[model samples]
Target: MNRTVVRTEDLWKVYPQEPKPVEAVRGVSLEIQAGEFVAMAGPSGSGKTTVLNLLGGLTRPTRGRIWIGEDEITALSDRELARLRLESIGFVFQAFNLLPVLTALENAEFTLLLRGVPAEERHRRVRELFALIGLDGLEDRKPGKLSGGQQQRVAVARAVIGEPALVLADEPTANLDTATGAALLEVMERLNHENGVTFLFSTHDPRVMERAHRLIHLVDGSVESDVAQGVRGGVGHDR
Candidate 1:
């Protein structure tokens, strides 16, 4: 079976600052299981994004270990880590980083194309995702032609099109209005339940945290609290 869980042990990350060393992530450890919809919740500068970066293989931790299933990722080479990201992990960014020149379908199919998925198979998969993401007829529309919500949904399609073991999304709804962000969150939750994909997202939005099955709060570079299902206020801002 593919590794569907992620684990971290005594993780730490520090950046070189001009004045003094700035610690980004402190002694934080946790496990996220398959199909879990988790939110890394906190205010700004709480290290949520830093932790997401470490987990997504976009950056390495300065100390400790990270495991995605059976593989320990902290020791991997840059090339190897890049390969791991392409193979096992998917990422959604706040800015909806779609290629401006590409159509929506093209953007969603980009990763599969890089991994050498055949054209017919890739199109079929992307078409299905487009339908699921409520972008069926807009498949050929460019990012600039779409609204913020639509663009973000396209980004979501791109992230999960290849069916990665883990999907890391950072501030996915930050650019959308309240109704649009809630709608996007619903789409993600539906995907999590239907596709059995594990999703870990960093957000300051209480609406995002409220929909999460689990919440991990970060403060001062450390995990301030880890709350499981049904604990809404454990790590969220007030409405």
Candidate 2:
């Protein structure tokens, strides 16, 4: 079997509300292997976001166990959880959360800076990544000056800069045009395939579901199906 990088057993998340408790996620059990590109497909309020948040260590589960590698996330202190997130998880949000005052290159290098990578090395790696994403000449531009697609590319670069083992993309392409979004997915796919970066995406995008090697269909806070898409180990679904 492939090495399991993330595992969740009987996971549950409940939020207190005025009328009643909101059960956001219900008894989710999943194991994500190293380098696998998995997609979680569901409509709004279907627990997709909850699953992503749990996986990213954004919030502790109300019940059950979450493991990253062999470490149990639910057992860790908050500081330890934060450290784990810094070292092992890379997040790409739909908002493209680039620092407004930073240039594209600076945004991409932010994570590396936090990691204490020397400035010269960070610049070198940023150049290579910018070229990889076809944003070579736009490195000096800030997020506001770049197109939505460009900003998203910068976000991807930032996420990958740390070389985190797992990347959690939450509606990563929701803001882009069709062509741009497809290109962005291709870039992410290449990283997952060639660099062995595992990806777990929370998406309603048919394109994402189609391209993903594994489809995890969620409905009403429960898993409806967890199927291998195409041939065993191949991308099987498309819009």
Candidate 3:
């Protein structure tokens, strides 16, 4: 049986506002198993990002609990959460947060560097992913020298280099052109199939939704629908 990499129970996030509180996530429960390519899809203010953030330990929930692998996130301290993220979770955001001063290879290996990976093994692992994520020859180039797509590829490579149990991506394809987005999707797809890495994305892009094995549709802070992949004539829900 595949391990459950992420589990959330009755999660909620309420932002305090004048006269009223905004409920970003309301009573959400979810389970994501190993190797699943899942997308959290919803319109704006629907809590897709909130759910992802809770899962990734980026934000504390207003109420309820989350488990990433064996760690119960709600019970952890801030420092513990930081350590957990460094060791077990990876993040890819819309902005492709690569350091301007770092080379593609350096940016890709940044997390590993934080963990004190030695030079030879770090180069080996990052170099291997450059090919997998399609950033091969550009390893020596800095972020400013790369195209938007290439920068995102470097980000993706960085996220998975340590083989984290879960990768959370928010609007991953949001800043790319059509062709570039598709190429990036293809790279992610290959990694999930071949490497058994779990991916969870929060996105509204139909292209990203279409490529996912499961679509978790959130509306007004709750699940509107949970859809298996129907595009390929195969059922792919929560498998």
Candidate 4:
């Protein structure tokens, strides 16, 4: 059986506003098994990004709990949460957040450097990953020198280099053209299939929804439907 890498129990997040409080997530309970390619889809303000932020330890929930591989993130101290995020979770954002000053290789290996990995080992791993992802000859280029698609690939390389248990991507393809987005999705799919890297994305793109093994739809801060897709031979079921 596959291990459960993420679990949430009645998760809620409310933002205080002048007129009234806004509920971003309500009573959301779900479990994501290891190596599943899942996507959360919804219209604007459906709490997709909020849930990812809550799961990634980027924000504290207004109420309820979240667990990543048996560790209750809701109860952890800020320091402990930071440590847990560093060791277990990776995040890919829409903006392709690479340091402008660093070379592609340097940006991709930043996480390893933070963990005190030796220079030689870091270079070896990044080089191998670059070659696998069609980034072999661009290691010395800076982010400014790369195209939008190339920058996003470098972002993905950075996220997966440390071999984190889960990667949460928030509209990673939002900034790319259709062709670029499709190529990026293919790269992620290959990683998930070949390396068993679990990916969870919150996106509005139909292309992303179509390719996901499982799709979870949200409306008005609640889960409306969760179904497995047929594209990857996934069994259909409600969560």
Candidates' TM-scores? 0.93, 0.94, 0.95, 0.96
Reference-based lDDT, residue 158, model 4: 93
lDDT of 2 by residue, 13-117 (tens): 999998999999999988888888999999999999889899888998999899998889899988888888878888899989999999999999988898789
Q: List clash counts for every candidate, in order.
A: 0, 3, 0, 0
lDDT per residue, candidate 4, 1-239, as tens digits? 67888999999999999799999999898888888899999999999999999999999999889999989999999999988888899889999999999999999999999889999999999999999888999999999999999999999999899999999999999999999999999999999999889999999999999999999998988988889884442344664
Q: Kindly list the per-residue Cα lDDT of model 1 for residues 1-239, writing each as its tens digit.
A: 32447999999999999999999999998878777889988889989999999998788899989998777999889988888888888999999999999999999998899899998999999888888878899988999999999999999998999898899999999989999999999999889988987899999899888889888888988988887765321233222
Off by over 4 Å in 2: 231-239
Indicate the worst ten consecutive residues by lDDT in candidate 1: 230-239
Instruction: Quantify how close model 3 is to the true structure by its C-alpha RMSD in Å.
Output: 2.5
Specify the highest-TM-score model's number: 4
Task: Give candidates' CA RMSD values in order.
Answer: 3.5, 2.7, 2.5, 1.6
Residue pairs of candidate 3 with colliding backbone atoms = none
Q: In model 4, where do residues sit more than 4 Å from their true spots?
A: 230-236
Q: Taking the tens digit of each residue's C-alpha lDDT, what string does model 3 give over 1-239?
A: 66888888989999999899999999998777788898889899999888888887889999999999889999999999988998999889899999999999999898899899999999999988897787889989999999999999998998899899999998989999999999998998888888987889989899899889888999999987877783321234431
Higher lDDT: candidate 3 or 4?
A: 4
Q: Per-residue lDDT for 180 in model 4?
A: 95
lDDT for model 4 comes to: 0.92
TM-score-best of 2 and 4: 4
